[model samples]
Target: MIEQDRALYRPLWTVSFDEAVTLVRAGIAAAMRHQVKDLLVDTTALRGFPSPGTFQRFLMAVEWAEEASGRIRLAMVALGEMIHAQKFGVTVAFNRGLVNNVFTTELEALAWLDVEPGKGSPTRRQ
Candidate 1:
């Protein structure tokens, strides 16, 4: 977890599924306290598989945070074990359009946050 320029950047959090919820809760607190507008969560470093409960709680926290502050932008990069979490039954069901956020590679994720989506990207360039 890293904080830069009022933006909280979390490159990696943990291997334990339960720990992930704690970390997310912390991140949400930080974001709320700082009134951060940009939140970058990189799950590329996740090592172990997270259970359905973990994913569910994580999503719940995110939803809560977003509802609390609609201006906050969330970017999540899923890879490896984290990708597996995306495939979990609950994740699959509730993951769609969770946010008006962007899904892309690390570089693209940052770029997406830097610029408004659908303004220049393929999704918007059309």
Candidate 2:
């Protein structure tokens, strides 16, 4: 789980596909309760091909986020060798509308999400 100062930012959590769906659900609930406007999801450390079940969970999470408020933005950071660019591209295509935006660098991601650096909302995407 990723923590941040509540006064300046919202908390971000890292989880595998197995845990992504659940986390997304909880995140949506929290966002609603807390009126969070931005969310950064760091997929930099995510490695390996997910099982069918995990993939399904990941899809569910994306869908949930999409259906929720458009204020939330997901920053998916793909670390070197952790995930292939082709696979990441495919996933991005499929979830284009699910997330506000995606990026390969933490700076770009934060910029796309309109998050200021050093505010505890650092997340990268591939």
Candidate 3:
């Protein structure tokens, strides 16, 4: 169950590239719908991304996010392998004027997003 504490969002997924895109788009739209400025997205279980298209996939997600929220802080919790060594994808997103980053743990993402643990109501999606 994906939950939200204030603007904090936590969703776990193991889907294909296409499904991931759909989720990213919907997730950002949902955060915007709730008027969230700083969003913490837990994607630690996110999987099935095509090996060679990770960069392009991330670009699409970031673009969708930008279209959804304009300027918003996005923190994501994902597996280590999903995190680029140089964080190039993150850099690209940040370069596009979106405050974005990826972490290996929820705590780290929450800290980055400045969201307190266990505070506010969680709004579940799907």
Candidate 4:
């Protein structure tokens, strides 16, 4: 399942091929609905990777999102080597159009998300 939370406008994903696509679709929908120019996605909970075909489909969805939102800045929180690798592929799939980075900690991710200190912290739970 893919759940988008209001907190930090963050999206959390379950580890599955279908859910990954759902996450991508949901992200695009959320961006369009909110007119968001940036996104912080947390995939630390996802255990494995989606299949190549699933990944491609997600990429296609993201490409369409690019047209709607221009260049969206994305920060992904992927705490471990496995998760980091998965996010790396996602960043690469975004190509050069989007600014994407993967981080191991929520603080770093929040910083990259561009929120200034003292404004409020986007809780990691979401």
lDDT of 2 at 103: 53
Candidate that would win on lDDT: 3
Stretches off by above 4 angstroms in model 1 are 1-6, 11-13, 51-68, 80-104, 117-126
Error of 3 at 64 (Å): 3.5
| Clashes per candidate, residues 3 or more apart or on different chains | 0, 4, 0, 0
**Using TM-score as the measure, which candidate wins?**
3
Give model 2's TM-score versus the native structure.
Answer: 0.48
Instruction: Give the C-alpha miss distance for residue 43 in model 4, angstroms.
Output: 1.7
Candidate 1 per-residue lDDT over residues 1-126, each given as its tens digit? 445533544646445755664565566567667766666666566556553465564565455444435445555565543334333422332243322232436676676667753354222211
- Residues 3-116 of candidate 4 have per-residue lDDT tens digits of 242223344545575565466546656665665666666656655564345456456446634643544555556556534334544445445345555577777876656653
Q: Report every candidate's CA lDDT.
A: 0.50, 0.47, 0.62, 0.52
Q: In model 2, which range of ten residues has the least summed lDDT? A: 1-10
Sliding window of 10 residues with minimal summed lDDT for model 3: 117-126
lDDT per residue for candidate 3 within 19-116, as digits (tens), equals 76577667777777776676676766677775326667566656765765544667777778766776766766665666667788877766666644
lDDT: worst 10-residue window of model 1: 117-126
TM-score of each: 0.56, 0.48, 0.72, 0.55
**Better candidate number, 2 or 3, judged by lDDT:** 3
Displacement of residue 70 (Cα, Å) in model 2 is 3.2
Report the lDDT of model 3 for residue 63.
74
